[model samples]
Target: MDRHKVYISSTYRDLADYRARVINFFLSGKMPDSFSLISMEGYVADDIQPSDKCVEDVAKCDIYILIVAKRYGFIPPDTTKNPGRFSITEMEYETAVSHNKIILTFLADEKQVFEEDSDPDAALLAEKKQKLLAFKEKVRLAKLTHPDGFTDAYHLCFQVQQAIFNKFFTEIYASREENLDKIYFCDRRSQNYTFQKGRQINKAIQFFLINSHEKDMAHFFVKRIGLECIESDIRTLDLFIYPTILDNSDFDDLEFSMRCAIKEEWNRNAELKKFKLKDPLDVSVEKVLSVMDELNYDCLIISWEIKSFYWKNDKLNENISAFYEKYDQVNATLKTSKKIFFIGTVSYSECADMTFAQFEDKIKSIRYGATPIKLTRINRNEIKDWMTDFEIEDNPNVQEKLLHDLLPGPDPDFYLSDLELPLRNILMKL
Candidate 1:
């Protein structure tokens, strides 16, 4: 079997733990035979320049996965051959571009900032941050599909899985193209509360706010809406449209990013080729609705991530509402459209001061008139039940032993944030 080589690129010391989580998934999780994740940890050698070796690895991969945080990373020597002081990560990106590799990019949310190069000088640190932000902007504008925020390890792996599946549809299934949506090919190995009969899923619900932290189990339910919405007969959502906030982008910028992702998706999809999508400089409500009117799918699932958006701040609201008229109408289409369902995740620190009602009132979001699901905490029974439901580990004694391994203080009740790392370790070996 020929597996896809996915290069995971990021600054090493800052995001070491994050790299480990995603690497574990591609190494030993459910589909290890089908895909492999490549990173610096895979091999070590001082015989070669790190930049040259990194670019060499990127050239071999079928896909490139780039995760960027606040660090500008190691700067290789500038020479006449390659004349700029680009970070090794940037060099690998250039290699990917030259090779025309399929790229899936994830940017860190605003709250996940790292000090650049362990610098103590505040002025120098700020300047390096500007460089990082500039690189992020370059990455965003260069691709038809915009880069998304990295909320958690599970979301990273799932995004990679979905993106690869969509891009290499024929290769994954040995050219059985019809099995695209019909197949539920992998297990839900993340620390999600499932496998019990207690979930009250509403298949008809098309819009909602998920009041869960991005680091917790909310992502699982978001993916569930895409997969398990049985009443709509959607085997799987046709495309992923993630338009996230990054750097200094305003609300209008976010909308434009979303439109670009959506337009590119429809234009690229063979079945949806008849309908044309247009890009206009001015985002009028009419133009947005016109795009919506062109949507021809029976059902579609779209995910939105908003970070560094202080909804409760009157000053920020003032800046946002000026552009709100157009977005208000555009979001309305998704809210009422029978063919669409959306899952939204917001930055935790940004919204901490606001209540649910405050969020609803200030954002005027697509979450209007829908029930939000909270996935913060789960008990011991849910974990054991999830194991049984997926047949991950069948023995009862083993289940308790694993629970002890997963949580702290000998308590079966655990926060999903606390359970994520250990559970991912188990799933890697499962």
Candidate 2:
């Protein structure tokens, strides 16, 4: 029965009808009963000052919605030296910003400006217009407002509904439970590979599956966690992924091949058949961080090959180094608040290419407050043995057995365990 408080701020005289329409839309048709609208219409009282009441209400609001038209409504009296200069609407917006509330601004089309016979003097009107434009520019520069224009009350109502649904409903109400954990799996892979049932699941294949079909994997991860803690208070899981993408030159063909392989594998399993999947697409780190802030993710899982950290070319090395530095900053900022699992894979040949010192330096640079789980080396002899067994093995179940042999077991390396213990210690803090 929890409700979200929304404060509507605007120059009332010109936008009165538009405001009424929007409030009606939310109260009667668009939103659920849990949304409470706060506006000037509801603050009328005999003794209380309207401006003071509006500011107080805005401070308590969870979301702030501002509508701006051509007219600059009545400017409230200011007690300071700059008295009667700024509109009450502007004051409400500043109050919302001070409280760090989620603000959404809707700019009305200029053509729909309201006309009044008793309008303010010409100079005052021009100054008000300039101030409104300046305010719009400020909000736009902050990247906080949408670019769409509203021509009528109905159009404005529709825009408000869309904004509410996208930002509030999906990101907040739909997954609001404190017991629901949001987990993201970021997979940076060179190619897509298939997995065999009995054979062990390698890091590359695990990354591909986790990133490409996160919804399905959510169920799997939740079930696995449930097995470990039967009486835990956690009740739900929300999974997300950052997918892999090839450059333009190599994308078309590889994407098609990956699709076919995925379809074939999915068709073979009944449970997977019930699930739908799409090709994974690359996303920027900024976008990932934005989602984390909005959804309040509980954990993030990132896996990559060791070679991805190495580059023979100086420029490529610099680029990778810069990326990790930015990544380190972000991780440090959120370390105390969230749980992170970073897994690195090393092929036997790759490990042999570096001395102990070189390998140790690589590990130190990429640790970034993460539990670095190193996959066991895969050697040529093991590959040969697997190929030889595949030819002679008659049971269809041999593939599953081979997978079990190859995948990392429950116990990781000592270093990985050392890094994980501290992280696990803080998981129950929330």
Candidate 3:
């Protein structure tokens, strides 16, 4: 008989360090000797591509561990190259979903959730952005009914092992009576119930000013599941993060688009002080630097086109040195890793060679330590491509029906015939 194999998947930013620690805890442990597990870190010696190995591992393994964190995984870092591929974390989830593999997920932060009615930032990222929120809803529902969601970190390892143990001992080897005792999992507890939101919620929610009322929702979920029955119910859990930026300003379309597409967290400031300026260049750079100082973020995602103008300003050529000086000052003060990812070309028509060339020159001038950096230029071409993919995956029929049914009249009309030519045509025909 073959042993069941398990594979673990995670995003490296924000939660990778913690995930590695958890994996190590399980890897360097006293196991039942019969059980087996494999991970991405294990395949480094084989020279196998991480994504390929992950696909293979998920295919072979009976179970997969998805470390759901706030950050989306990286794209190839060069959107000018291949943009059709999946992020590392997304590839893992997608593979598991397609293969129908039993995925055992651990939600890193459960308290944070998408507020359905919030004003959307950047109309461009709305589609991908909405998908992320919907995914969270599904995971939240799954956690409410899965065994893995209820178990503590200590017992989580034991319970997963015990599931394997039951299959071998009871299924493979015939036993007279079922292990009924194992089914009724209960620990010594004098108190009826105690609830506390995880630490990730506290740290993350602070930046967004998410009120206590929002934070307290996690406890409500725990209560609904019931302490004793929580284990028996939940089978597969999902991790989700409600993302926000500093200054309480909504995450911009560019930031939202990049973050959601890649499934990585944007390095955001906790808060920023106001510095009014007449020049757009001065205002932008000054605001950026102020936020960077407040947040202590090592990485900065500069708007490629805007930053280039500042670099090329004739009057501020000497003064622009001050901008570079401030950048250096921040670099010197950095205590942790400072990696940057640049976003470019939200519209494909804007993809002039000069725009990219200008961006490249500006990027080269910004000095930092030997930090890993990636520049993603998302012109109209990429947006159309992304839009096409989203259209395919997102069941447009359901939405269409919903719109038709929910609207006031038989015909869903929003705009006049002449003004809304394209949209009116599509809506009317559909």
Candidate 4:
């Protein structure tokens, strides 16, 4: 049998983990070992200018999987000013699309998009916001479709992931004879949840892999890629579109409280449901929603905080407001969710006594039992102790046992923050 070839497309810095994940998936023998793909790094080493390899690899692939994430701009070679028009990832995508290989795309989830307006530095944030806007435009034009009608860089990734799954899975059933006997593909995404997006994609992937040999398989693949590309390109979008707050102290206590709430919920529901915790320090709105949508948890606790100071400068006011707006937007969005507990706070260290009081007063006005929690009087030592106990590392033997049960080659390394030390430092004097 002729080995099938796949080529991956992605921004090296932003999507390195993604590339590894995809490559690992294939290498793990989930698919036939006869299948092979060009690693993005390997392709780079073989190209004329190193950068041009992405373009050429796409042209060569039987299948091209594009990993679209938040950042998709030209990565410069140390010095900045030469041939600055296109990014390596974008060029690769264009190459695949123009020559028309079977292109499958996956967008990382929205939780990956980081907002910079809350940065303590003013000049740095202005530059970041400008870049964010540019990246937003690029993503908006790239997504094939979006869920909840959002088309920002975050949602774009989700849509691409799903579309790719459908395109590839459906194509496989049409071409491969070996998989003809396979029935009832596993839909891990929806097996236990109300949401069908994940299940649909998994089914699609199963279909694509089964029918890999049909001569016209590329035709179906191309159609899916083109439609998604065009759909995202026609509309401009922004995922995080809120005003900035000028204070560093914004959302301080709120963030901590929200984290505590999430921890509480994780202990209760996630453990009961046998869900392994990925992020232990904090939980966001999306995480809560995912927990709910999947029926993994019945309750969620979330908190928000601002770490800013007033005396630093007025120039940073806009950035501060923009950061504040994100929390406000999130709070407003979760106003009606009775299952989710929301908390907000402003750090007293960065604000004047009067300003801190005013901030607390403002939060008191929120309708859904959402109000300022005055934790400033509480010692940082108390919070540190709580977090230290909260993020406890799993017992070393537990990981070994899980691996032993699976019969894997070796036990995986589990990262543990030193409970003896503070998880992280919170501002005291600011």
Question: Which candidate ranks first by TM-score, i.e. highest?
Answer: 1
- In TM-score terms, candidate 2 sits at 0.38
- Identify the runs in model 4 with alpha carbons over 4 angstroms from their true place: 42-49, 73-84, 113-165, 169-430
What is the clash count for each candidate, in the order shown?
Answer: 0, 14, 16, 34
Candidates' C-alpha lDDT:
0.57, 0.46, 0.36, 0.39
- Which tens-of-lDDT digit does each residue in 164-198 have in candidate 3? 34434444324422222221111111111321221
| lDDT score for residue 153 of model 4 | 36
Model 3, residue 209: what's the lDDT? 11
For model 2, the superposed segments whose C-alpha errors exceed 4 Å read 42-50, 81-84, 111-113, 116-120, 171-430
Cα lDDT of model 4 overall? 0.39
All candidates in order of TM-score, best leading: 1, 2, 4, 3
TM-score: which is higher, 2 or 4? 2
Best by lDDT: 1
- Model 1 TM-score (2 dp): 0.52
Tens digits of per-residue lDDT for model 4 on 41-139? 754421335565566667878777665555544443423422533456656666777887776655554443422233466665465456545744664
Candidate 1's clash total is: 0
What lDDT score goes with residue 80 in model 1? 49
